[model samples]
Target: MSKEVSEEAEHAPPKDYTDPPPAPLLDVGELRLWSFYRALIAEFVATLLFLYVTIATVIGYKVQSQNDPCGGVGYLGIAWSFGGMIFILVYCTAGISGGHINPAVTFGLFLARKVSLLRALTYMVAQCLGAICGVGIVKGIMKHPYNSLGGGVNEVASGYSKGTALGAEIIGTFILVYTVFSATDPKRKARDSHVPVLAPLPIGFAVFMVHLATIPITGTGINPARSLGPAVIYNNRKAWDDQWIFWVGPFLGALAAAAYHQYILRAAAIKALGSFRSNTRN
Candidate 1:
């Protein structure tokens, strides 16, 4: 009887195998084409919104003096414009593509395994192109000293050194990436945390905080594209020269945040998943 029972168990089909098999791969060329189109449109609209507010703020500040009849918006006002733009964009499109309005955010997501490498590269290219177009539009609209109007064009102010500027960029980017990782962590979701409510708020405030601290130093370009847009049109050599610091600092900070979030904080969860997979295989 024991032998018969064992044979019956071995011969029976697995209970989980009752479901239908997954569909075979199909011709996905059309799907890919449509996806690309949607992504491009989304990027263009988002970038235009961002640059419009940013450049408008800069122009308003530069052209209208403090003593002018209509007082200009000050530096703090400009900072608020940037933060508010980001908050609106994130709330609008975060569901579609995680609202990576900046390339550094895209790179960080790729490092965290939230986005694929190919997607990351594509998103970066899209972001850069959108930024250029956005600034180009601003140039067309503004009649004043176009070079000086767009938030100083990433140039360091009178007293700030290159090292100091770079330090500010690095520190600002580090804080931004750290906040991003914390806000988007899946474990936080598992714990029923209310991240989505203040997701855009925290990110926008992070930008505001960075600018508040670093505007006097390097104009606080935590996003390379933000610097690149105005710099390209303005023919600003200082902005071009210091562009490397913006890219390198933000990327390095993002990498560090991704590593810390994936390996350090989630090591136990990873081990637990490994054990579960091993048991399933057995």
Candidate 2:
């Protein structure tokens, strides 16, 4: 009788039979075909909106200076326009493609294991292309020689050296990326509680702050694409020469922030995984 009861128990279905299989880590079909295309389009459209509004502000300042001669929206205006546009676009597209208008953000997320390398590369290309289109449109409308406009390219002012310029960009981007990580973190206090009303606001303010601090020093290009647009159109040697700093500084800063968030802030999960591994080994 005991042996028969044991055999009956063994033959019974598992108690948690309703539990679903774990989702695939990567959906080859979606990642290769659908996600790639969707992410690219999202990047392109977001970047276009970013550059369009930003460059429009630049053109407005220039045109105003020429027309009004006395009163014009200054650097603050340009900064606000850029920052506001970023916030709006990010909120609009965050669900679609994570709203990474900057390559630095994409690379940072990739490093943090939040995104894949292929997606990052696709996003970067789309951003660059969108930037080119945005600035090209601006040039077409203004009929302004790219050279005279300096293509809205970023550069160190007369008093600043390359090192100083790079430092400014690094610091500026660090602030931007850090704020982005905080705002978008699903586990963050604001996000977890379902109170995300102020999420986009902080990001915009961070951009505004970075710009206010660095515009005078390096034109405040936390996004390389922002600089790329005007620089490519202007075809300025100075812009090209200084371009490396924009890419290097922002990327490093973003990577640092990502590392901090993933390793430091999320260390508990890492430790849990380690413990699980050790238990399995034992």
Q: Per-residue lDDT of 234-253 in model 1, one digit per residue for the tens?
A: 77676788888888877877
Whole-model Cα lDDT per candidate? 0.73, 0.79
TM-score, prediction 1: 0.80
Candidate 2 per-residue lDDT over residues 81-138, each given as its tens digit: 9889888988888888888899988878777667666677778999999998988888
List the RMSD of every prediction in angstroms.
8.3, 8.5
Cα error, candidate 2, residue 102 (Å): 0.7
Which sections of candidate 1 miss by over 4 Å? 1-33, 66-70, 148-152, 193-196, 268-282
Residue runs of model 2 more than 4 Å from their true location after superposition: 1-28, 66-70, 145-147, 189-198, 268-282
Error of 1 at 3 (Å): 38
Best by lDDT: 2
Best by TM-score: 2
